[model samples]
Target: MRTVFIFMNEASQAVEIPKDMQFEAVAELEIRREGDTVLLRPVRPNWVSFAHEPTASADFLAERPCVLKTDYFDLSGAGESSEEPGQ
Candidate 1:
């Protein structure tokens, strides 16, 4: 509902988001357009990107055995149900 300015940055278009609306400590934003509306979203970090990085921290990449504080559900029989051979 807030009004924002849309201007050109060299060749591509850019929007100047207000400081109050800006995402804290974020260097990038994920932009997507649907129909006539343009959406701006904060780019949250995921483990896949970290795992693929060449210089991740040793503690993060280390094979440290972890103890589960709470019980975890067993997935041993997850997909053993009867199905077609090619399925």
Candidate 2:
């Protein structure tokens, strides 16, 4: 079986790859979504989870506003953060 890791967002997958394209060596896929459409790309599967972190400092945050999310999350209700309903 081919192991595929996908980042879930807004009750949909952020990344999806065809079964045929998923080879033994290929474990990870990258995707960026606009509404319901998904654009698939190649990535390092092993480090997908590792990439989910706040890379900006306080100065950076002041310059640009952004929201951070974690890997391996639920979208139907509360997200990975066990705090609120929409967060």
Candidate 3:
């Protein structure tokens, strides 16, 4: 396994992808976290994940009033197996 370093870039952090570990063909990469583990995967051509990817503002997950003003996700009782369609 190769080693890398983390550095600052503007307000976020960036990992210095070593020359040998670089993905030169891809312009962008998806970096996400799962629990305590972080994963970095390359975006392949015609990737299915890009076709219908979920998008939101950078702070959309935040509880800030300005960021989230509506009940975008307050569908607590909307869908249920017992409920009828178009009810």
Which candidate should be chosen as best, given lDDT against the real structure?
1
The TM-score measured for candidate 3 stands at 0.43
Assess candidate 2 and give its lDDT: 0.64
Name the lDDT value of residue 17 in candidate 2: 54
Identify the superior model by TM-score, candidate 2 or candidate 3: 3
Q: Per-residue lDDT of 1-87 in model 3, one digit per residue for the tens?
A: 766788899999888777877787788777889998788888665768677877888888577447545766777776667967799
lDDT of candidates 1 onward, in order: 0.82, 0.64, 0.77
Which pairs clash in model 3? none
- TM-score winner between 1 and 2, please give it: 1
lDDT of 3 at 46: 77
The candidate 1 region of ten consecutive residues with least summed lDDT is: 61-70
Error of 1 at 14 (Å): 1.0
Q: Residues 1-87, candidate 1: write the lDDT tens digits.
A: 898788999999988879888788888888899999998888877998678778857688477667665457877888897897789
Q: What does the lDDT read for residue 69 in candidate 2?
A: 64
Better model by lDDT: candidate 1 vs candidate 2? 1
Which pairs clash (backbone N, Cα, C closer than 3 Å) in model 2? none
What lDDT tens digits, residue by residue, belong to model 2 across residues 30-73?
66889986566667535665688557765765665556766557
Question: Which one wins on TM-score?
Answer: 1
Best-to-worst order by TM-score is 1, 3, 2
